[model samples]
Target chain A: MRRWLALILVFTFALVAPGTNPRAGEGQAAPEFTLRDIDNKPVSLKDMTGKVTLISFWATWCAPCQVEMPHLQKLYDTYKDKGFMLLMISADDARSVSRVKPLIKSKGYSFPVLLDTDTKVVSQYNPNKTLPYSELIGPDLKVLWQHQGYTAGDEVETERRVKAALDALAAATPPAVAPTATP
Target chain B: MPPTPRAALVTAAQALLLGLGVFSSGLAAAGEGEERPEVSVSGQDDLEFRYWRDDRTLPDFPEEDHLFDYWELVNRVNVKLDRGPLQLGVQLDAVGMLGAYYYLNDVRVDEFDLHADGVTFPLPLAYANLDKAWLGYQGDSAQLLVGDGYIAFGRGLALSLVKNTNIDIDSSLRGAHAKVTLGAWDLTAVSGVTNAQQVWQDNPNKQQIRPDHWHMVSGLRIDRYGLGPLNLGAHSVVYSFADRADLDAQPWEGYGRGVDAAITGASVEAFGVAGLDLFAEGDLFLYPGGEVLGVEDNQPGYAVYGSAAAYPGRVALLVEGKHYKDVERVNAVVSRDLYEVAVGPTLEYERVITEDSGAAVNSNDISGVRLRADVAAKPGVLTPSLTLGLFRDRELGGLHFNRAPETIVHPIAGVDWIADSVHVLANAGFRVDKRDDLPGGVSLGADRMAHVDLSLGFPIGSAHGEIGGDLRYFMWGDNLNQQTDFTLLTANAAVHLGHGVSIVGYTDWTDDPLIDSVGNINENLYAAGELQLQPADGMTFKLFYGAYRAGIRCAGGQCRMLPGFDGARLSATINF
Candidate 1:
């Protein structure tokens, strides 16, 4: 009887043991990293403090990512003035900067093209190594939500999530406290 | 306790029951309230039957001695919930198939089992979303999640989801992630592993096959800046995977990196001139070992894809061009390879035809220039659109793999009777190939085929009834200096009684010149009917029957290798 009970316990543990990552949900601080864009300018995660941020990781070869580029432009237009900023990063080879740079010019995307030629940044956050992933972070640098895979109808979800995060932030900020006159 | 098979059976049975019990428990919350406790279930099923008989028994193609039968059934279930800041979900699907038309044997179907936490099914299939689920926490400004999910930055030219469902594959990430947003910039970092599932397995021991694990890490940062009528944006996605000796039989170190950028702008009306739109984007991938993990490499594997559809009142011209190269690189990463190059331009002219009767139709005349090269590198086809109403699709390439060039010439034409809901369509085309270079026993020299089809559909009673008929004639001329011809007629009726109830029935008949040596007229007739009922939100029950008059049966691009079959089919999908 004891042996059978022990076996059952072991099986149960196996079913529940796999998931163990720790970088999402509420109250969690984002991981720190610094990298350079395609133009060779250094960029850091800490630089965008105190503002809402939309961080996206993608590669040029992804078809759906290509389709969603113009839609991202729409979101940028609607919320940029409301403290919404986006960080775009790539893990392309440093040698093909010429190829990548010219192609970027042709597509007409309005986002900066940072480079992680060594892939140091890629390994820091995206473990599966798949491309075209996005994470939405609030003004306080907390990751509000993240999603993977781009289908025909994903733009709606992306817009809804971004707007929700922005609204929540807007609601939390207290109106400017007015100075009281001395009696 | 000497490890008897019965005990193992009992233990396995207990686990199975436990899982099913949990699944039913989740289904117990189906009423429109508080969101069903975060559990979701979905599924699909199909069944088919065919029958065939030959007038003359030829040596090469002998008639079947008995009737053939085929049927299939499948079911999928999922359950998800949250634990404090952590989330979890489990999914399972079982498939059962049976057919004796091709070879006499037992049913063989694949089994799938998936599990995750803190994540939801992405798009497409909500049951497949295992992207993120792990121990994590979130505050007002920053948050972290660990497990499986996807990330993207800029245009995902060099990196993106490797989603191709036709062959059935979904790339998933298993790892840890961190994100922080401030002002106009967002920063995120993640690390994990993939290829944790064995690519192939036999049914006897398929469950034991575990995915191969590889360590990977990546980070991204994006900042948007712009001016009036002009915007300049930049983003980068960087990732690296630790080399695993087991990844490949050969010894080699592996790592990957990529970057994408864009600049977009448009003119304002202030100048009284129509705004001139301008934009550009690109991506570069750098991974020595990317090929092993399904990442394309070299030749930039790049694309400069864009389109312009400026609107000026009732007229619009849209033009788009995309250039993809190093097509083999994608194949190098994964085992499958499909490459294509195409450029399409469309001119749409739309003017309100009539406004009184709610009748408005826009006409679209499009032409496409496409070049497709399959694995054989032969039959490099060039297809072009022709005619204002019917788009003529022709294949201008040699044959490969003893297979005829697909869609020698297909014309797409349709006229709407009552706007978009009711329509009539007619298409006629000719396809011929004189390719003398074909495998013996499969050559069709001097062969030509022409076909015409007309179909019409409209609402019958209320908003659910639909009636349609299709008539098609195929004429094969001068094949090996011989003539072969055939004609087919079909009629269909469908009624949708709302409330998830539908009934559909169709009958088809065909006549053709026989190819058998004995020489006899080839005749085929079939009738199929199906009644579908969905009493609840998550359940579908179908009762179908089919009868065929000794002829070949093929439909929906799927052809059974077995002989013709005749039988009844029943399928169902239940949530609880």
Candidate 2:
């Protein structure tokens, strides 16, 4: 009994220890990780420093995720020129990863996709590991908003959050100087 | 003594609620600015109440017992804890039933005994079980997992350990598993005890019970990826049973001792070559200490499976072949549960093979080939597919039966068309079974079987609802010169009544000539209606009334036979 109690105490201490938990949440700094895209190219979260980023965690087996894909594509098309980036991370395992490229091609979705076969990246962003989960990170590398699960018409709210982050980032940045003094 | 199933369920529910409350409070206390441990809780519940009556003159039970009523509630809770690289998950399933139905009383609690305070319990009408629990750690290129979890290897040809919740089948392994990746090579090792039960005795007056024994299993797999469109892998597993003396006293002593069973296999997969994909696997099974079924000097077993597919433009083609010789059915463990035993690699058209009107397809001692072709007339608008299958028993020295070999052939065609909010699907198939030799040296020739099904769904104009209908017909002729035909028709519609309320109704009619001839009973008719109210996100309430017929329900290569019912059901679901 004493040994059991000691083990429990140690486990509790470890869980509560400082810097032991690395979950990304609203107002918290987003975790950094490298992942490979469908083309087998490595991409990292630190690369997009000046753009509002929308990271969507998805899977082919998730019905809601499938429903939300087209909406994410639309959001990407509408905001790409406005300094916004969208990354779709698939949580499919190694066995089902082969189907990802075909499914995306069949659907004609042009957004960049990253493979999270081992779920290492997904676990850092969304601790619950729920599919159809999304996070909006500001240009400052802080998570501005996060949403779990999806329903019909939920994409409107997501777009609203993304636009809000984009507008905030624009307001914070200094405008470019006009080079008319030389004339 | 251990608590009753009901008491245990109630306690578990209470504890779950309390834990959620405390965790939520902790999160609130930590505030949004501070770093905190991650916790997630989610679950779903299904409640159904059924009242049934037998219409047949020759019923399985007496007339007085023909009419029965029952209610069942199933709850599933998933909890996850994550801190840095360490993660823990616990899934609990609790089912409580109060009914006079015999099927409900036959619930198997063998696997549940592992965590039920180590006390034996009777198969009660109300029971709950802890389904799965696991702890995992993820590092740069390696991982470790311990406890109950699912695992699969190499297209699941030789081994697949998974859970089928819809059919109440759980084959999770309980032990340790590890995986490591080095460059292009990935290796995995698993050592675990099968969390399943085996029936040792059959009581003439009661339901079958499981013995208190566990099976031990260990396996290793190595896979190499990124070989320029070529991948190779190999896997091997060993299974060992408990002592013979412990099993001899059991009722299944004649079934041979379960000591020393092993399977090893190699697989090859290739893609990105001329728009074609190929996969092939071969496995060999060894039984060191005699045969599994007590046969004298039984030989080893082997199986080979291969498939090839190509998709170019608007057309796709696929061909598959499989051969098995004296290979016994494989499962995560030997299960006493009637619905869970005999699990193997999931195959295409599994539902048709298992639920056919005639004799079901044999999983072992057989060789077969299948071909499928799909053509898209309008890309996503209209697509049609054709399928063909031919199978015959392999030469195994009459291990299965003394009768001559028989061959079965199946040909099927299907089409799907979707435009805007309208969708339609139709399928037609024919099956023929021919025997090489009949009893008394008489040739029975071939028996014909045919079936067709059509379904359509369309939106209801501007009402934001949908309406659907389905029609199905089947005909079969047995080798004994008996013919049977069955037809089913159903129509359903769902309309949003506005204000977060919806109403759905469905009606069904079935005509079975065989059943009618046996009991001179009337045709069966069933109807149901449901009213749903969604007051908030992730929450729903449904009130339903229906009359249903006994049928087989299948999902993920697992099937369960459900009893007929006429009932009213109320259910609520909430996730947070």
TM-score leader = 2
lDDT of 1 by residue, A75-183 (tens): 8878888878877776443212223433343344467667664343453344333456677777766556655444334456678888887788788888788999889
Candidate 1 total steric clashes:
136
In candidate 2 the C-alpha lDDT for residue B19 amounts to 45
Query: What does the lDDT read for residue B529 in candidate 2?
Result: 89
Per-residue lDDT tens digits for candidate 1, residues B290-334, read: 545454342233434333333233222223333333222332323
Task: Tell me the whole-model lDDT of each prediction, alpha carbons only.
Answer: 0.39, 0.57
- Relative to the real complex, the DockQ score for model 2 comes to 0.08
Q: Which candidate should be chosen as best, given lDDT against the real structure?
A: 2
True contacts kept of 1: 0.00
For candidate 2, the docking band is incorrect
Identify the CAPRI category of the predicted complex in candidate 1: incorrect
Candidate 1, residue B300: lDDT: 38
